[model samples]
Target: MSRKRVAEPGPLSEHVPGRKKACWGILTSQGSWADRSPLHEAASQGRLLALRTLLAQGYHTNIVTIDHVSPLHEACLSGHVACVRALINAGANVNAATIDGATPLYNCCASGSAACMELLLQNGAHTHTTHAHFPSALHEACKRGYSQCVESLLSHGADPDYGVAHLGSALYMSCLHRHTECSRILLHSGAKVNVGRDSDSPLHAAVRQDSADQASVLLDYGADVYLRDSNNQRAVELAPPGGKTHQLLLTFEVAPRTLCQLCRLHIRTVIGPSRLKQLPVLPLPSLLTHYLEYT
Candidate 1:
């Protein structure tokens, strides 16, 4: 988006003696006319003086773009700590979400801006709010391996088990983004290592994400090796072809048990077809819950 640059002058011109209006000349030069907010432009360009001036003159800190991206989102993206602080002090809603439901904290953390993240969190930002448009800030932090920021959000009650639009959980995101250390932290902090959401298990995420370290961590934390994704692919099948990570899964085996074909097939449908063959045969009993646990 483009914004009009107002000439540098004091706000609100007062009437002087009558003067003739100057005739305007259209420049055939390179530029085209633009339409956007002065405040938004200033914030986006990190023009601290203009931003501060606007804020001081009572320009709205809560101004947003057509897409509902906030000034805070711009400030965080521009790495303008001073502008961010000024906007927050000017009573900007620190937790304000964009049109996509991404909060300022989510933007800050996603951009790897630890200082901005701390400021947002200290100023009462919502670490637990999930974005229907995408993953939460904890997921962003974990995905990016922003360990310090991750710790900060976790301290402020960010849920390790939080799920979002495509990402299953913080653990899932960490795996997907290949942030091995962050995955380890979340798992140690009580993230469900074996759970799936939106039909994606951590094993599925790890293999698809090409994260050997994260996959190992998940296995150590009891990730189900035989778990499957929506595509009917096992974790082993998801692994990159010809690698130690692939070999590791090939070596790990679950003990065998006999199960009814219908129940087993139903479980396979829930999990995936590729995993069905790996499952041990189960015994016949009035099936209440057909799932089995190696532990």
Candidate 2:
């Protein structure tokens, strides 16, 4: 589990003053290992002993691969909590970005590891880091149906609407993937129910994916039923013909909201996303509080 620090002059011997040795020699030691360093491999495979030994032998924890992916990114992407802790403890840059601008926090969310996510956030990982493909950590969590990761990101103030431009909102992603739990969590956290890109609303995305459950959840959260997509089709029109999703949307479109429901929706809008969690402790009746909380 240990490696000798050979003092030979080679690719790893060109010492940048004040910098740890780059593990480029280790990367070229095997044909199968193309761009990854020894630290990246050990951290990626959860090889704690090897990872610890590499750090102990003065291998730079901040050394990045050709794509600018550090060992910390590998650790978080693989959900290797021990490796993540080792890298963080050894002064790995938690906010280091890949060539596409993805951070270790975004990788953790992609892997659906709340433990790694919490550790990264506690160690100063930026939740707002967006990549070319992913808009935010919250968007990654929603796309992959990681409800726990989504909740963790929300609690840490990850914006639910962070990626509206490229990937659409987190709610839209969750609905597109038919992740009812993630959609519920995002809605309860005050994600905009009707928010979408120019092409589709969350409801349209849900029905297009044929997710009746997600579409129902969106309706319950007061999503606008009559919203149109870029194709000028309503959500009900996009639903599968003679399918449950179509039926549900048709019912919602025909049935008018009760006065109490309208009042609850207005109250939620007035309180805004920040104060939505306070509805439970208000002086309202338990049933009313539950209603306001979208129980």
Q: Largest TM-score belongs to which candidate?
A: 2
Q: Candidates' TM-scores?
A: 0.67, 0.86
lDDT of 1 by residue, 1-295 (tens): 1212334333333465542222111111422222235676787788989999988886667766546666777887666788888889888898777656777787777678888888888899988764355547887788788988787877677776777756677777777778888877766555677775676788888787777777777776667777667887789997788887787777665432234433533443454423333344544342423342211
lDDT of every model, 2 decimals: 0.68, 0.81
Clashing pairs in 2: none
How accurate locally is residue 28 in candidate 2, as Cα lDDT from 0 to 100? Answer: 33
Model 2 misplacement above 4 A: 1-34, 130-135, 281-284
Q: How close is candidate 2 to the true structure, as a TM-score?
A: 0.86
Tell me how far candidate 2 lies from the true structure as C-alpha RMSD in angstroms.
6.1
- Please list the Cα RMSD from the true structure of every candidate, rounded to 1 decimal place: 11.5, 6.1
